[model samples]
Target chain A: MELTGAEIVCESLLKEGADVVFGLPGGAVLPLYGALSVYPAIRHILVRHEQAAAMAADGYSRATGKVGVCIATSGPGATNMVTGIAAAQMDSVAVVAITGQVPRPAIGSDAFQETDVTGVTLPITKHNMLVMDVKDVAQAIHDAFHIARTGRPGPVLVDIPRDVLLGDKTEFVWPSEPKLPGYKIPTVAPEAQVAAAADLINQAERPIIMSGHGVLISHAYGLMTDLAEKAQIPVITTLLGISAIPSSHELNLGMSGMHGMAYANLAIDEADLIIGLGMRFDDRVTGRISAFAPNAKFIHVDIDASEVDKNIKATVGMVGDLKAVLGQLLPKVEANVHIDWLQHINELKAQHPSHLVRESDELLPQYVLQRLTEVTQGRGIVVTGVGMHQMWAAQHCRFTEPNTFITSGGLGTMGFEVPAALGAQVGRPDVTVWSIAGDGGFQMTMCDIATAVEAHADVKFAILNNNSLGLVHQLQELFFDKEYIASQYTANPDFVKIAEAYGIRGIRVTRKDQVLDAVQQAMETAGPVIVDFMVKEDEGLYPFIPSGQSVKEMLEEPTLKEIT
Target chain B: MVQSNHTEQHTLIALVEDKPGVLTRVASMFRRRGFNIASLAVGNSEQPGLSRMTFVVNGDDHTVSQVAKQLDKLIDVIEVSDITNKSTVTRELALIKVKTNQMTRGEIIQIVNLFRANIIDVGSESMVIEITGEEDKINALHNLLSSFGVIEMLRTGLVAMVRGQTNGLANGHSEQVNSSSNS
Candidate 1:
């Protein structure tokens, strides 16, 4: 079948099963957008900012495990997507960002809207290509999707020159198979590593399983839970590893790190055999590398080999798909009782419990999260921006399924929740979608409200307007001698008015009594709705152990008795 | 997770038809599959057309062999070989600028002379030292120079080639055929 290069691009996308693309049109991308008109099956979302388009795609990919697609024009459009692409790379989200570039001849001459987007995005993307030849367009798109969707998935940019889009391409041959030499997906877990891991699990007196985002990405949650339960091992999660095991599970010890649960951190410190699953020991988790579980014999399992010894030393390092490694080790692992370890963990949990007391007039963020969790029954998708709100959501919101809760864990990118929620809603329209963002982070991508309004995406955004960078302010108050620096942002916009500007339903909740009613009203609305909850500015997240410190060293709750 | 201490080193150089993501795919392969790469370097080759990549990695002999075999399977890669012990010429270049005042200048000069490194650029307060050798040699120099205050350091990671009268491209074809037949 003979098709133009632009048609071939769209056709290849359809072939790869892309249901939607987030983008905006410009002179360079007119032909591709024109070609997209013919394909009614694929929905195209026009985001206000090119950055949001890339972020929306990232969110879509993270939620659905599909290649999230985004399109933008040349120059500024391409540059705008860099931050989003970098965020995806950092967190390992599968995304294919397609940008239209000037013709081949004008690439270096700085012609109208001309930019070497491939060069600009080189370091940020997993891989990138600039297509000058019409024949290579189809193959490039095919290869882009393949590269984006496979092993340690990340963003791949394909910059299509404007002239190439206008050219006539008759030979439309998608590569029968992607011939990437260095892209091998290791299918088997090394038997020796698996056996060694099983032996360590069997012999360990104080065993702790530290789960990370890789477990969810590899779909090893069930296997992990089974192993933890059967072996009677306590499980602690990284911020990204939340929902890997149900928060309600007895073995689940919530989160560990700077703002992690006291018990979780304590367990990690005291553990003799630390089995790290699908997680890189970032500074947040390890606090002080030298002092972090100094006595523990570490068993690190992750798909990324580079991460094995890059951080903490591992006694048993297995590099393969977490799902496969856990599968192989599951049967060989003997069922044993770590009753003493469990008792110690329980004691720690009792010592420091997350307690939030809502006043009669003050709208607490925890209450909103708890109510949302109740209404959703942990069945729908919940996304959050980076801040105190995110920690609250992670602590309070119970996610029962994989891919149900998406947040920027590695990069901790703020302004991620709204667009991510939009993408999640688009990907899974049948399920309820909730975006929880702090006042500070919410304003970063607040424009995405228009994206929701335009697509009529059924998403509910809960803006916890504490009127400050709550996380930073909390740290300053606790550790920085109460000197707020770059944490306070006064004179904020009326969120209700902003939502109204986007043609979406908006409500403001100042009192605790109005919190549930506002949320319920937003949920009942058919399309996108935003409920701005005026939370307490002085409110702080609790159970925060200073970084590099032991879990036992955490401040159980706010020191101010009045706030409590 | 079981940690295997048997860190087998293999040096692989691939001659690829210059294209994008050929490196990413290769790096992604090692990264995603958890192949321990000791050192990796990629740049334009002598051949007017192709790019050469050198990868120093630690894996089982079978796995390293499989990686070479797999490289041959890639359409863009012209050749790949484990050049760890194949009589290869290996070298690495590093430019390290040290922060030194009058007090530390004599000590820095002494360290540089002991390492047989050349001083590329000399400032009133600093000196840029150029050193080329194996990775360990560079590390040793870096360690000794750290006390004198290293202001900046840039290493052009290891680039290698077979020393004998043989080209990787020629051997690549036979291995490709052998692997295809084996498959």
Candidate 2:
């Protein structure tokens, strides 16, 4: 039973049922790499960058609902994992990041390749540990997996010192249980609050359901859709909650908030009863807190109790797991609700649907997103980088199931899609993975294209190239009186050339007519492929109701008249 | 203003690396959890480099348990125990600054004398009284002195140790010794 500390780490991972680990080898982590060679059951993916390792693990965790594991060496190797860890934390992905550290004696002395990896990532992770002892290695790994997957799932870092990894240990014994005093998972729903919510829903004349990423995370999409259908309520999803319900459904009102459909925003404004599910009312969604649904009676249901009253007061607050709360409320709720409200919502939906100018020659971001959705038939996982392309994917992509469309919701981290797609592809090899990134965001971690090629993952990168930080540029044009600032990046590299350099297939589309062909070609490529769609810069995401403003005050449609 | 409402309470114990900034992270966590610590104590354990943090908090049992679980999840925290059931001892230290003029100086001194509190420092208009006991005992003394204008207060959060000699280091210490000898 005797094993080296490094061997204990690999053994503990196997015990936790990890079949694969995504990472790269370095000096500090040589011990782990040496130990990993003996275990043939667990596959170690060599990523091009440490950041991609973290993203791939995030994707794997989201797809499998298990703790995604990634490893890296000390210093820059550990620092590179920060973005991915922060993304996972923001999106509540279950990921365990293992990094190598300098020896214990040299920790504060700033030894070779020594960095305070734990302190650097403290704010970004749910929890982290620096293992200095050989005996604590197994327990630390076990505890890392346990903490990452339990309660509100998030990333946990386990930094093993180089000396400890090389140190000898008598036996590796994983902790039988994690004894955490302050980390209780709330399992019971308050009966009074549930009854009150049900009563309000039944009595309300104008009820609207607002869904968020929590609904998808809890896998309560079915219950949510059923509730909307049974109660005849119009459902409005946040950008992150796009795939929680099918867009084809009669009750689906597209997205809500700044760039939401005219009807969804207006409906929220007029609603007397608002059932907010698993969504923290971000500034994008609530224009102004004071004017946000002022007349509505709010019933907020979330697993995190802190989110309930943090922003936007709630008339009834139910704190527990989303699916469990909905499971209880569904039975007590009545079926076949009043038809008048549904008809009113349908009328609004028909009156003002999401429409864009369809010119035959002009390349548009909307056309690219729609074509990708068509080519994939909404069957594969779609990850997105933050910016104009993220909003486009959220608005245009037709998602049929939950957890299929993954993006950085809370943090809105740019350059998230490419590596995240690699992770998702590794997790679900049978399914196709599409990473939608803008020109600026795609450059952030496009080196991960090499990782995709190495892994031979079936991933397609749809780079919406506008040659600018599209979101920021749009904001500048609208709010800052056309002061472009640092939003524009001149002398942009040809993404196709860069993709070819990574040993991956590449294509470029300059016209709207070529979008479908480019997407189809990328989809059929055996390995990773990048399709750079040359979109026009300076196109604003429309129907934006400025933050802190009422939904009624939204720019309903793009106007020919210029703002004074 | 003290509310006349009954609140639930629980005991929490956390094993953390004896280092700087560890206490700050633990304190921030307590503040974030919205649980008021009744008593807190921190001291070096038999394990040369680790410290044991013990605190009693008031909240629903589930919330208290959650707080313990969360504290255990901290990177500096090696282990966590809710020694509410297990045999353990909990204590806290408090220093209260009291405002006393000619009218209430004697009364203030009388209350401090009764509680066996020591006067650590004295100002022109106020005297700082130091006391160490269970949180309830300090609360009782605080309640008694509130009638005579209280100026400031400093309370160390509760830290607890398990009964007898079953320390964290002791359990693993012998095993380490045996392995080293065998090698």
Candidate 3:
């Protein structure tokens, strides 16, 4: 039977088991939005801005390990979504962005609401196509989902013209699978590389595993644990790889790199053999490329071959899916012990522990995050914005589940928490979703509170309101000689009131004693709620390593300022 | 991502979907990665719905491998092969138009004839010579005609195929490096 391009889109979405789409409707996408009513299986959640749609989809994809979908019109809508799309591309999240273009006749005519969106997004997207014919709509959507959800997953764009969506010239033909000859998904690592990795793991005296976002993406947490446990090698997670292995795991050694766990960075620095799994050695994780893991021989395993030698050259670069590579390597890996290396790392951890929160009435951000971690007990899916609060959340809020701690890692995009939490809630309704963002980041996407209320997204938001943008403030203090400038904004709106205005319960906490009560209230009160913690201003993220410096230059305490 | 090493010229052939804007995708990749393309030749391939692209890349083996991997990652690209060190016969076609008066025209033709080139087009004051050979051979002919004041020159980037008893495009270098779902 013949169906409009819009119906084929809906049918294709259902075919891919896409239950929800985060999108904003515009002039070109009006027909597709209208067709959504006919397909009740796919729910459409309207976003306030086009950018939020992409971020929400990215958050949804990362949290649930499913291909997330977002839609927009041409021009500004597509351009606004670029940042979020680029974020997904950087972090390798699986997202399909369906953008509407001007009618075919009007294309390239400098038409109204028209943009060369495919061209604009070519560099940022894994793949993109402009569907000129109605008959190809299903193929485009199916192929887009396939490309986005496959190996080394990333965002893909499918631009459809307004006329194509409204057209009814061709019969609907839904191909069971994409016939993409070029798109490749690597599954297993070659035997030689796996054996090389095994030999390295077995022979090395000071071996460590650097778990990356790919670990969580491939669901290789079990295999990651097995590899580390069998060799008794310590595991250091990258920022995006926070939840790959539970923080409570004996072999798990917190996070690494700039603003990461001090011990983790030092351990990476001192290790002789580094097994990099499913993670790129991002610059943030490697302070200075020349000095990063100076003595370590790397065995890098990732789905993308380009990523293997992109940063630090690998001794044994095994290109394949992390799960399959780990599986192949794990069997060949013999049970061994690195007792002295673990003891040395233990000493390093002892020498460089997290700053202890003082027992006082002042409500510290650390105390708040500590209490929040206790409240969740690994049940909450925590999404965070970028800043000092993000660092605090990473250092304090421990995870026992994979995909539970979601944040904007590679792109480090601010304003990710508020909407991302809602998207995470939408994807996993049975679990409690929490947004742990700094006040600055919270304010950037505070408008999404309305979206949460409208969609009935059961999310708990904790605004670590420190007034000033703590990260920049600390940086300025260190480098720019403490000129606060625009970074410090003491005269800020009461965030609790803002949340209340959006029709959600809001609580303000100023005293240390009120931290527990505020957190408990936010988590226990159904629906959606917010708690604004008046965290200490000028709170520097500790164990800080200045940019372009190696792990040896990590400052265990705040420099340039005397402790109170 | 970029490394400076013993730089050498590498030729790559990519089999891609015969679709619109695909060339733009390939060109954009080279431009974005800051890889200088010495020459690029594209045309229809033997397979239906597929096109062939031949380009010369100047970089180390790492850079060539990176270029191949990145190109293979494109959705429209079926496969990419680096035939730099392969046993293959390669050729390029160059059309050189030299500003020739009656005095120098005869000498240019004789020089072209010696290089197995043909004088394809003759103008009132200029002559166009077509040469098909290795890049160096064409350059040699072009150099000899340069003193006669060459007006313009166009070179079709190198195109290559494996020698007898070999399939250059069906080699293991591309397959060994790429591990994908369908593999």
Candidate 4:
């Protein structure tokens, strides 16, 4: 019954069903690392950087639907996890981050490796606790997991002082239930609001369901698809909502946003009823709030009431679990196909087919992604870093399952794919996990190649190596009159050589013909492999809406020619 | 001044378990959401191990409700109600220090007596007067005392209650009140 705080932490984690923890050891966390040896069931992954630790835990959480645990020493270690924590918060991934603080007496003295991690992570975390006493350790851990995985899940931090971990001794008893009083999680929405939403769906001649990450969180993909098909509504997914329903589904209208498919954005504009489920109408999705879906009446469904009508006004707001709302709604909604609307959507898709330029010997990012998709048969989980490549993957890859197409959609954090893919691979060893990154972003956390080698993660990296920040370069070329500054990297590192140095197999392909073979080879490899596909530098996201412009002002390649 | 359509004062009453750092959680929520508190007061509630916090928040009607909703989501919070539009009794306590001379001391006492305020502390050259009233009344007294060259002033913000026998904490206004209370 008696245990140190460190032992209490391990026992609590075991009680919470955490089989693995991703973290790095530092000065303040020595006691934790010492105690970790005694508990063999909870495996600890030693990441190269604190950021990777957080990112890996985020990936694990997204892949497994459990609260991923990551730990770090205080000060710089805790600060390094800031980006990953924010990314998890933005994407609503459930992660419990633990940081070691200085001893209780030395907290205010600014002792070695001291930081106010609880204070620092307040805005980014759903909730956080600083355990000043050993008695509070188990309860705090229990509450951290409970808070992180509940309704509208997010990251939570528990800061344990070094002395608490090493000094204080107490009788440890795991509470049968977490003593969280104020945490009321909504399982079902109000019936009247659900009926009102159902009414709106039934009444609309052209309705569009804009699905977001909530579908995956609630595991309501079946219900969402049923609602979409039964109502004969087109489904436009947010960037994070990519795999809510399979991309190949008849009603699934691809991604909708700044870099979204032309037809999907057009459908959103033309729809009379917009049912926004579990996704915040972010600025990127709605170019100009005043002009966004001007003709549509919104029916917002989310677990968090605050998100409803925070951006665009919701005519009918259903605040609760997405699955419960859809369950209540499916019975009332009548099956009817909007034939005219479907015909119009087809016409728009025909007009703006995703540009697939396959000139001799030239490798386009889209071609690489499509080839990668073909090599994997779209069966693998693709974790993407941000940039033109991310959009390319979103547009080109076929995602058949929910939570398989994971990315940092809300925070748009680059360097995410590498560590995240490692975590994903660790969590789901049976599945093929691919980390797709641009050359610029791949370099940011390529240090985690060592982590992949150490963990023996069977993750494949599809580096769309354009040797520059392609998205920013395209922006500058389009808007800055070709005055490229920091966007272009004068000397990019040879990624294959770096990967090889890190003891992972590496291959480079400059020509389009080599993409398929390289991707296939990387997929066939026993361990982590990086395929550097040298893509064209000038390639830009087509049907792009300029900043501050309405969806109506979208510019394709021809429109760019006209403007120039 | 042309007022923004979104700007309005919202009075919120929250019942939270009296535990360490509950105040910090509530305060941090407001700070993180960037909602400036006009005034705030916290004290032990009628229920044991429970604290009631009254906050005057300045935000649009939508955002104020959002703050309340977010507060309810915190682990320690038990219940939150926007008592802004409710018929309620609100009171604020303040201690005002005014620089009073021989010429103005008698006049200050007369004005204090008129407002039913007490002179809590009298200094050699100044007087610290105490008053408890609605915010408007306290402001009025402060305005009158300012003419006598006010030195320092401290206000306890505002605390409120509904007019009738409706117990804000006991009713099904929140989850698990009776369950936790029984234990």
- lDDT digits (tens) for residues B1-183 of candidate 1: 223346687889887766756775666566645667777898888665568889887786556655665455444566677777778778999999999899998888888888899998999989999999988899999999898789999998899877766764445443443233210
Candidate 2 segments exceeding 4 Å error: A355-361, A559-564, B1-22, B28-183
At residue A211, what lDDT does model 4 achieve?
93
Q: Write the per-residue lDDT of candidate 3 for residues A1-564, one digit (tens) a residue.
A: 888998989989999999999999999888898889889999999899888899999989988999999999889999989999999999999999999999999999999899999999999999999999999999899888888988899999999999999976678888866767776778898898888888888889999999999898888989999888888999999989998888788788888889888888888888899999988888898988998888899999999988888777899998898888888888899998889999988887776765344454577898898888888886769999998889888888879889999999888999989888888999999889989989889888888888888889999989898887889888989889877678878578987778778888999998888888888888889888989888887666788889989877887664323233
TM-score of candidate 3 on Cα atoms, chains taken together: 0.96
* TM-scores for chain A over all candidates: 0.95, 0.95, 0.97, 0.97
Off by over 4 Å in 4: A355-361, A559-564, B1-6, B169-175, B178-183
Tell me the tens digit of each residue's lDDT in model 2 across A1-564: 898989998999999999889998889999999999999988999988898899889889987787899999999999998999998988888999999998878889988888998788877888888887898888788778877886667999999998899876658777776533334454548888889899999888899999987887788889998898888888999887888888778788889888887778778878899999888787888887777877799999887765665566688978778899999888777775758877777677666666343444567788778877888778889999898888888888887767788888778888889888988898899899899999888888887788888888889988888889988987888789998899988999988888889888899998888888888888777989989888877667777787667776777545422222
Model 4 docking tier (incorrect/acceptable/medium/high): acceptable
TM-score of each model, in listed order: 0.81, 0.81, 0.96, 0.96
Q: What are the fnat scores of the candidates, in the order listed? A: 0.05, 0.07, 0.56, 0.44
True contacts kept of 2: 0.07
- RMSDs, each prediction? 8.6, 7.8, 2.8, 2.8
How much is the lDDT of residue B14 in candidate 2? 67
Question: Looking at model 2, how many pairs of residues clash?
Answer: 28
Q: Residue B93 error for model 3, in Å?
A: 1.5
Report, for every candidate in turn, its global Cα lDDT versus the true structure: 0.81, 0.81, 0.87, 0.87
Candidate 1 fnat reads 0.05
